[model samples]
Target: MSSSLHSPWQRHVPQIQRKHQHWLTDTGSLTQKLKNHCEQFVVQRVRQNRAFLNLSETKSLCLPLGRRILQRQVLLICDDSPVVFAHTVTALERAGRDWPFFNQLGNRALGLTLFANPLVCRSDFEYTRICAQDALYQIAQTALHTHHFKVNLPRHIWARRCLFQHVRHQNSRMMVTELMLPEIYQLEKTSKAR
Candidate 1:
């Protein structure tokens, strides 16, 4: 049985999706540059010969080899895959080394494993540093802003906080697979009321 009823904007959804896809692909170079910048920060800070970084569609930080990697120094930061984040932690702990590299990382080394996905584990902690995004400071600048009836600011902000909060609690791991569509069905009515 067909679950969906005929929707007026069924045709428009595809167009909107195409636009977003185009935007990401067009900015692919810039995204790569951004990822490179993030890597540079870690490389510059850690003076380790054996360092491995993982980049995937879902963005996850992972340890290259499980038990074999115990002797080497590895730091993982997975933006597209939180599963990598969880696994890295588990592997590191299993390796059972305090890892001198942690001295170089300092506080930056404390938190990096994300638990929200449940796929990531604390054992990867030896090689993975769990860190949470500074959502409040990141949004505090525009905490109070002009209203855009087309976009509900309150709900948007709340959702962002919720996601950030949940991820932080789980070792700052976040994998945004889908866009959070704004509930602006009443946008026209809200705009008219104003």
Candidate 2:
């Protein structure tokens, strides 16, 4: 007789579905697809800005392989916002598998940024622990943690999505999107090239 639906969990259905969608989207997209998009977007932007690199555009950047390259170096940019509720390390691992070169080049430098720093939080602790177990390149966080590789976490922008609109200031954004990672690397290359 009432206007309510028969479903018991209907009230939370939207939220549950949203989370599932996010997971599926992130997991379904491959790293190469992300990297390719990033390359095109970043290159176009750089060209417009008069700061483009002269790398071999024809040659596809084949990512390295195995533990040798894996131990070479890596820089992980994590926008560790509580609202971005998804498995962080697990997702990164999948990305690595998807793009062996991207992960191998980093060797193991993992960088993290939280939207809001939390003290004694279980999520924070677990994130750190999982990253360590993964043999990350290096783990840096805003929160105090006793690690041999701790460094001053850099400024980063956080957003609900990785699109340009969702991104804030480029100079201070975390840029956690898998596609954007290569763009970040390209920028670093440009800086060095300059």
Q: What's model 1's TM-score?
A: 0.17
Give lDDT tens digits, candidate 1, residues 36-152.
423222211112222222222112323332222221122222222110011122223432232323334432422332222334333210111111232221222222122111222
Best by lDDT: 1
Backbone clashes in each candidate structure, one number apiece?
A: 25, 19
The sequence of per-residue lDDT tens digits that candidate 2 reaches over residues 48-85 is 01111112111111222221111111222322111111
Among these predictions, the greatest TM-score belongs to 2
Q: Please report, in order, the local distance difference test score of every candidate based on alpha carbons.
A: 0.23, 0.21
**TM per candidate:** 0.17, 0.19
